[model samples]
Target: MSTSAPPDAPPALRARHLRKQFPGVVANEDVSLTLRAGTVHAIVGENGAGKSTLMKLLYGMHRPDSGEIHLDGEPVRFTSPREAIAAGLGMVHQHFMLADNLSVLENVVLGAEPGRAGVLDLPAATRRVEELCANLGVRVHPHAETGGLSVADRQRVEIVKALYRGARILILDEPTAVLVPQEVERLFVSLDRLRTRGLSILFISHKLDEVLAVADDVTVIRRGVTVADSLQANEVSSRELAHLMIGAELVRTERPAHPADQTARRVALGLEEVSLRLSDGRQALDAVCLDVGEGEVVGIAGVEGNGQTELIECAAGLRRPDHGTLTLFGRNITGTTLRRRRADGVALVPEDRHRQALLLEAPVWENRMLGRQSAPPNSRRGWLTRRAARRDTEHLMRDYDVRARDADVAAASLSGGNQQKLVIGRELAAEPKVLLAAHPTRGVDIAAQQQIWRRIEEAAAAGAGVLLVSADLDELLSRSDRLLVMLRGRIVAQVDPRRTSTEELGVAMSGAGESAR
Candidate 1:
């Protein structure tokens, strides 16, 4: 399929010699980019390559150190996000910005609510949202509470909110990081429709295949500089794109599992007859069973909200399963507390890094010391040793290659990739026997993703049984020795990762395959 955007369109947005600098990092240095109307322009690069920083500058979240921004034929400068929005620019952040307590309509129209005489015009706002949804082919219930909706639904709400604000150019950051194959297709369809309506989109993604599939043009950035711009997607292959982004060959080495090596290794983690019921009485998990042996990497592949989160929570001791038997290292831990599980050597790289893994407002040192500050040399007699913590934080920062101004900087201030590295570093430093990694590499750049995969393999080689839950089929299949397909809270099939096709996995993930127990 041809990946290049239509060639004859005029430029809708343009940036010239953009520059941004933090304390120790020149985020963007003489970067230039142009977006054509009715096209999907993709920005591709490694974490800390200044892709996000450039986007932030364009969106008015951060003012450029030196740059010229032009909308259509007029030069412009935005001091804040509100000014950018007023100028027909909208940005859907990598992390969601919706209030869970609010209804979908309320979330879409937040801060710009329709009202008269201090009374909210709920009906009017809802009708407008309905019309917008229909026009964009965005499926969402306006009256539904945001908390009750799935990740994909929330993403749709974000899109609707941007369009509601009269945005002509939309920026989507890592839009497909959490979506399943089917949901990704639906999203692409919506983007295509929007393009047809003359909307320009700046799509940022780490997945090369997705970029090739939807992007009209591809831009590659390296070390805060634009290396390649407006490359026709069809003119280059995914492998070539990976090479361009990393400035080197990204070799995918595969190792065949030796069948004779599979012995009666001690069961490190076990789940039997696990069942969970939602608050609305819907069964999220239904008698699912799985086992992980020492030194084994068991991969769980499924679409988002298909009981993967519930199962992981049950195993992590975060949520009590209604009916299940969970064992860790031969000890029953079904009803155990999360702290107890942690003390028992259970480590987790949570799905939502910002919300569940790291404390955004806390300094990098504090986030690094979390869950392990009370152990060994860092704590004595219930008092945390600040010196020891700082030293350890420095070690992790250096070891993990986490780019930050300083250890004292707030976790939220770091880029998404750097935050992920910090989370992985902290969790892996504990050296637990059993590790639960959920979406461990989401939104990470190619180099970071490679590093994370290597770390997972290293942990498995060192005898730590790993359970990997991910939406990226290639990541799960390529790294894991065995793959278990989850559908509607049950294991539908088990297959050798090396042999399964993306098509077959998609079938299993969507519950469209022949019945197999």
Candidate 2:
């Protein structure tokens, strides 16, 4: 029923009436889209709107209940990811899946290695990786340790890894979520090169302008159904696309005015000459000095790995600074443990929620009891009262608008945006005086972003000092009272977010402009 393909030439990939259902949920229903050869086709939708489900069906992560997938005009059924890969398909997840300790070449040839009699063919694999990287215009050090590369380079490596596996059609998920503006442009260039070389790309992202900029055609899906497809990217505005995404016009949340009386504010959290070193002996925080005032939102803008993680960890007592003084409400707490810090009204929504925040296999109620396990309403006399925890979890779910089957459901069952909301709800429930929020709304939909921003604003309006770190320049500029840019582990520049633009802030973040040094 899918036209199958144009009679003369075949599309790269096509899905028709795809329906996938999970326990207690219909993830995808009546979904259809086509990826033409040698084009960047974008798929845009809200979180839990069937985009991921459709991608999984295409990539063979999950089989569709009732659908037809035609590859290059030939009907195909992929039983697993291996089959998909064998048929010229590859998927790069939002999180990069490379071991830090391994070399780029090693990670690329890991599972699908060419060998003779159980011995690896290192020379042939290296040649193939280099050839693929060159063809795709990917600039990466194949022999270098994957950990030492920048986020952008690592992403390119992922792309090369996919190509090395003989992928002609690539699926990129939230590829720009972690990149700064400059790096984003670089990635766009690489995608263009790939497209020109006849590789199809199915781009998925919540960033509308980006989709409009790079995609040749756009598809919109909503609530397990496809409402629009094959719309020319140059013909439609982002606002119109957003309306299609959520089935209505998007409403911007009203933000509280930035506190004007800066001189009258009290120092809620202070870091004085904070210095920390990674286990690899890199200077993670080079004499960084910062302060957050009560009732103020101070935003930090930085490329990831430039001390943002270490600074937040130091504040939350997850890492010990080699030399520094951390003060909470004018009291030094450099030696405080994480539990004691949580008990004293300090909380964090970590950057990588899966690795640093949640216990994926655990029930929702237990995850809600994570950081604030010792706080009131969920704990009593050195023990967690399960009933109290479940009751609060239920309330938090409603309050934060987290979508899940039930409080007893596993946290892993929810979508990424819902998982993020769950983490934010749990941290904010404690009513902490000092809040360390990193990438608070990194990869959520517009509606969920509004809710999360509203909650953060509410917390700050109630006199909590918010130190927000995010790669999203717009979020930082719109939410922060003052913005500080980090470069090579140091606070190199401070800009007035109300006056400065994202481009200017991006220049500052990369240490290329506006320091006035």
Worst ten in a row by lDDT for model 2: 1-10
Q: What TM-score would candidate 1 get against the native?
A: 0.93
lDDT of each: 0.88, 0.89
Alpha-carbon runs more than 4 Å astray in model 1: 1-10, 114-124, 255-261, 380-382
Candidate 2 deviant stretches above 4 angstroms: 1-7, 254-256, 374-376, 380-384, 514-517
lDDT of 2: 0.89
Q: How many residue pairs in model 2 have overlapping backbones? A: 0
Give the TM-score comparing model 2 with the true structure, all chains together: 0.96
Question: What is the C-alpha local distance difference test score of candidate 1?
Answer: 0.88
Position 74, candidate 1: lDDT: 83
User: What's the distance in Å from true for residue 140, model 2?
Assistant: 1.6
lDDT of 1 at 124: 92
Residue 31, candidate 1: Cα error in Å is: 1.8
The true-structure Cα RMSD of candidate 1 reads 2.8
Cα lDDT tens digits for candidate 1, 1-517: 2233456645789998899998767889978888987789999999888998999899898999888999975899999999999999999988889999999998999888889887889889989999999977977889899988888889999999999999889999999998878889989999998888888999999999999999989999988888889898879888988888889999875434746567778889999999999887878899999999888889999878788988888899889999989999788999899999998888999999877988999999999988777886578899998888888898899999998888898998788999999999888888888999999999998789988877777788888889999988888888787789888888888988888887788888878752865
